[model samples]
Target chain A: MSAPGSALIEARGVSVRLDGRGILTGIDLDVRAGEILALVGPNGAGKSTLLSVLSGDASPNEGEVTLLGRPIGDYRALELARLRSVLTQANAVSFPFRVIEIVQMGRNPWMRGSTVDDDREAVIRAVEAADVEHLLGRRFTSLSGGEQARVSLARVLAQSTDIVFLDEPTAALDLRHQEEVMRVARGLAAQGRAVVVVVHDLSLAGAYADRIALLDSGRLDALGTPAEVMTAERVSRVYGLEVRIHRLGASGRPVVLPLRD
Target chain B: MSPRIRAVGLTLLLAGVVVGGIVLSAITGQLAITPTEVAGSLLRAVGLDTVWAPTDPIVESTLWFVRFPRILMGLLVGAALAVAGAVMQAIFGNPLAEPGVVGVSSGAALGAATAIVLGASVLGGAGIAVFAFLGALLATLLVYVVSRAGGRTEVVTLLLTGIAINAFAQAGIAFVLFVADTASREQIVFWQLGSIAGSLWSQVAIVAAVGVAGVIAAILLAQRLDLLALGERNARHLGVNVERLRLVSIVLVALLTGVAVAFTGIIAFVGLVVPHIIRMIIGPAHRGLIIASAVGGGALLVLADLLTRTMVAGAELPIGMLTSLIGGPFFFYLLWRQRRRSGGWA
Candidate 1:
């Protein structure tokens, strides 16, 4: 049980370097429960790297992360896993596993050493929640990319963790599917689960995210509410392109658009 | 039938086939014995006073001293190789990742060659087997160490390291053969081809001990293996210590493969083929896969050995050769089918 408004995951002075190239320089951020925080950046801006660091998939070279008021390093792998679930950019499985089977994998941590009494129920709920019930019996690889993306979401959702990290969950999706993904993120947040998403679609982030953290060249450019952060100047400065901000109808959230050169 | 019941039924059927194969193998030599005779002799040997008459001297001697040991060794080695293959496939998350893919067979071959050429009688009659096991274990360790970095094993590094080590081991074997006398060279070549012809009760007991332990350990790892199919990051998120699991699986595979090759020579393809076929028939769940593979492997090898014994008049083909001959085409067909579905090799 996490206290609302307190950071579920906090990164302080986190830095990462891979293969002697700096991927993420010193950075600080906090992901509080009951909110959806979208990380938006240009390619190679270290958004995914930062997400990995915050999720404890990869440790930072220099700084430490704290999760639920405890140092991330102090928590065992299984303990961290129980609190957070990550949906990575690619959910490629080489085998011909069924969609249901893939979603069932999300319950592995809980099912370990105990009878899988509730796993079926959890999987069914997640499948329906993510709108992947139709894809249940099909082989995972046989599905279209958008369907696979939704199924992968179902897997992460089935994990039922308090903190969820999704990297481009709607990348392959059509417009409607993309909105459906954002709606699911909103649903998770409404359920009091913290959702962290990395998205290239600025409009989607603006529409769905409670807060948007804009990153540029491995640095945090802005961190505030979507309207506060998606200003025309900051958008152009970070993306190196002149842009305009338009308010979507009744939402008060600003949509970012690039202007013609 | 439900999937669960079908799996159980398949497992029982496989076990029965293995038992039948073993019994048939035990009685299939030049001195033929009926199944009733095998049961009666087996019962009487266990101190049960059977109603049947006493067996002839030559038949008794052949059955107890020679055939039974060979049959037992075949069963143990077959089960060990297939189970090891299944574990390797699970850990690597690839159906093609067999024990031999990591240089264990080549390393064991080099060890056997060294033992034969140098006449290293350190362990007396068991010297070759001991050296072979050590060689296989060392090769597996070398591959693990070379591929591992910062507590994670890169898949590409593992595959490349295995290729490099295997090539190096082949050079070592070539050198050993070059230096050995004619008789030792012949012995080395024959050993490389693999045979259960000279299997002794002592060898059977040793292989059985290692094989049984490895299979049990592999079976216990089935649940974790299922999680691993989701890929490494996903498996880690599911509470599996991916690095530790890989290490344990590697060591167990080495033990199973080393012991199997030590006693029976480089019996190729049993590990790779048996598991693949079982997975096709019973699905890829490791719980059923492990048990089915063990039984299926034993049955396949026992039948292969029987074929080797009876295929030609007063001659025998290498058991390893037979497996490879059958398995190579089946492997190609699997790849072809996968290509047809996915439109390309993954």
Candidate 2:
């Protein structure tokens, strides 16, 4: 699909209007294989909206989305789902499912003709990949919010599709879980999966993202490598706060730290 | 717990209860028939002709026709309501939802009440069932419309609105009950308080058709429901048609509940209790939960009815009263346990 390693996701001038107001406007972006594209912006900057549209979850009012060179609307629901997996913002539900049951739901889109053995192997690997092996047998409801998020990541990983969208995956995570999640993200990209993530942590984005896409006021503020895009001026303008960009001694990549008033 | 253990455990429990309930129901009555006589009577009615000891029509009729059909109707309606409760709990993402919570049961009652008031039974065979189905379908639509005003419904909000609508429907029934004559009053009491007495084979077939259909449909939709339990926005992100699933489930619950109330009147407690027990045991996987709820409900209601009819010779207590006597405390127990487990006032 889409030349095997070429742009797997292409959005052409897409815009989204929620209720009666425009929330996202004229967004054009493409994601390719073995690439981690980080979407970063202030709250309500349509970062999540852009991600949702790109993942083919929500429909856009003004433009078209093509994944793997085919119109997204033309693909069957399970077909589209089999090609991509999404981990949304931190959310909770009332049902008290077990951790394994939660992970097994990931196999639904692909379990149409597969054997039971296939699904079991995928689930075990996914649980291990998310570093939730210790938490596998525990109750999902009894877990803390951060722990639940990790289990949810295990679920999405069990889905094991070629495209992944992570919306603020590390927003609620502790420092260790944050690194653990992004390491999984990077690993997926390394395996030729197109991974697009919306991360609030600028430093994490600097370290993990192949290219960063910055959104401001429903517009693309900047899109480039961490070295080219994450300037002190750009951070100050986008966030309306003073910021400092420091380069790591080993990698020479930008790391942002905010300077508060 | 492992899924296998849960499945086998529920199966054994439901089987023991069902067999015991059947035996108890078969023996309890004014007729004073032996277990052998009752079995022979049933077998002969099915054309065995082996029970040749002067098969008095009255005794035979009461045993083969009355008690058996009543038992079958109880099983059908109970299973329908209970499975509906399980699905509703999953769909609404609230543990408290059952057949009665979402106005489906009340709507069914209203339909039957309307049929009784209108003398639809005079039109013969299918009239009561038709009117009941219409009443249920309409009430479900109303609940859905009110819940959809802002384009989404919180589980709590939908449940509370269901309570309000149920209260309003009952008020209408009360209005009808107020102006009715004595014969109709007895009929209304029987219909309102819930009873399996006076059930016929014809009615059993009708309720079973709709109830079984609804339950099977619900079980089939369990996979999609897994995605739905992720909550609305995330469910949509996972490529599930959330609105369509909601509509289908609500309509199915309505139809099954409508047919159930049309025949069995208004049996309560089974729906809510059965699902709660299943969830408590299995930790809320809809696939197994729905099936377990159905089997458990069928067995429980049958057992409750068996006790109700046997409690007094020559007279039957209201089946609903018996269920409430047993189920009310059980309901409170669940609330207490859930509150304790949640470790808060929620």
Candidate 3:
């Protein structure tokens, strides 16, 4: 494993085009261990697309992604799965599998190796972490949207991979669960896993992410600490709306809000 | 009850039913034979002489040649169709997916009809089976390729594709029928009705080999099939080679369905009803569901074949007709329940 601050995955000059339209273009980013990197952008700015490319889910039309010093394309699917876990936006399961069963599915990649021993403990930890212990016996299909999202998050956590990608993990959550999800992401990063999150809530990203990459029109408009990348002027220009930034808490995390007359 | 205990209990119950059906079928044929005679004859064939063994040569011959082959054929074909249905449901991630409903059976029937119409004796006795396998494979591939859109198979699209393929295969069968002579046409029609009457040991052996191999392969793939219920993209994320898994499963379904169809014509709804009922009892895990479906299917068809033999006082009914007669209503009930739950199919 790489050191805590070392790059776990690197993308160089990545571009993605779908149906003859550019979804991402000339993007270069590094996902390092021990930090939560939030990809924040307005609608259609390709935040999720970039996350997909970085997680080896989608191949970029141009450039390459390297994971653990090897070309991402060179690794077989199971190999990549052992190294990364992805929680997609949609968590719909066709069958009426129980919640515990779904979470145990996260251990599937490790089933063939000695690491299989970690399956049970990892599932228990993830269940507790995602606060889905109470929902274990319930059918996944019977859960509400927010409950489904948390159960899905527990499954991802149970995978116990070195790198984690969460796409809009808080979209369906209420305020408390939203904060809880971010805290889980923070906990993942603290455990020395690289967490890449595609988020719409700028304040939550700023509060939890060690670094923020602001995307505009499929390009990386700014990349730095929250205070630097989340300035009001750039945020306003990119989002086409006036916004104010307030620094709150002892850590001085930036809170962004739209300036409505 | 826990799923584990439930699976074991169901399996034992199905086994008892299968063994009972086999004995009942052996004894109640045109020539009456007692259960003791059936058991004693079976043991004597294995070189243990008993007074209970049938003394009449005709009784012994009837049990050995006629009843055993038909009973074994029912077991093999039933298990094959049910396993194929379970695999198809897992691969498509939809409970409604089944070999007969999705046109694989009709496609095999069309191919078998063609082989008979063309006088395929030059290709050896296995010509019809070979042709049926090819037809089933082609139909399965066609349905899979045509029905999928944006990396997922919608229920409506899948059913519509089945209808189109079934229509095309039926037309092909009709043309072959129009060209055939009287004897061949009768043979084709009888086969289409789906029966194991006068099944030979050689035919039973062939179905046993293919059915057993296909069911074992399906069991080995059970875990990966479970992952597929998460949808194609998520399954891939979990390290499943979704495309390869789907391709292999489709081929496996074709092989099982084709072999069963070649012998029995087109036994409908055993695939659909058996697996669905098993899943409802055992939950959606493919390992338990596939094994239970196989056992349950074998028992179902054995009992159904027994009913066909005994239902008419002096005649036999087509096993396929019996299955469809019951299956049609069960399928309608499932559709109605699904509609009520989902608030109508969009």
Considering just the first chain, candidate 2 attains a TM-score of 0.95
Give the alpha-carbon lDDT of every model.
Answer: 0.83, 0.80, 0.90
Ranking by lDDT: 3, 1, 2
Backbone Cα, N, C clashes tallied per candidate:
0, 0, 0
Instruction: Please give the lDDT score at residue A20 for candidate 2.
Output: 78
Q: What's the distance in Å from true for residue A198, model 1?
A: 0.6
The true-versus-predicted C-alpha distance at residue B32 of model 3, in Å, is: 1.5
Q: Which has the greatest DockQ? A: 3
User: Model 2 residue A32 lDDT?
Assistant: 86
Q: What shift in Å separates residue B280 of candidate 3 from its native position after superposition?
A: 1.1
Looking at candidate 2 chain B, the ten consecutive residues that score lowest on lDDT are B147-156
Q: Clashing pairs in model 2?
A: none
Query: Which scores higher on TM-score, 1 or 3?
Result: 3
Pairs that collide, model 3:
none
The runs of at least 3 residues in candidate 1 whose Cα sits more than 4 Å from the true structure, single-residue gaps closed, are: A112-115, A249-251, B116-130, B141-165, B180-186, B335-346
User: What is candidate 2's CA lDDT for residue A153?
Assistant: 88
lDDT of 1: 0.83
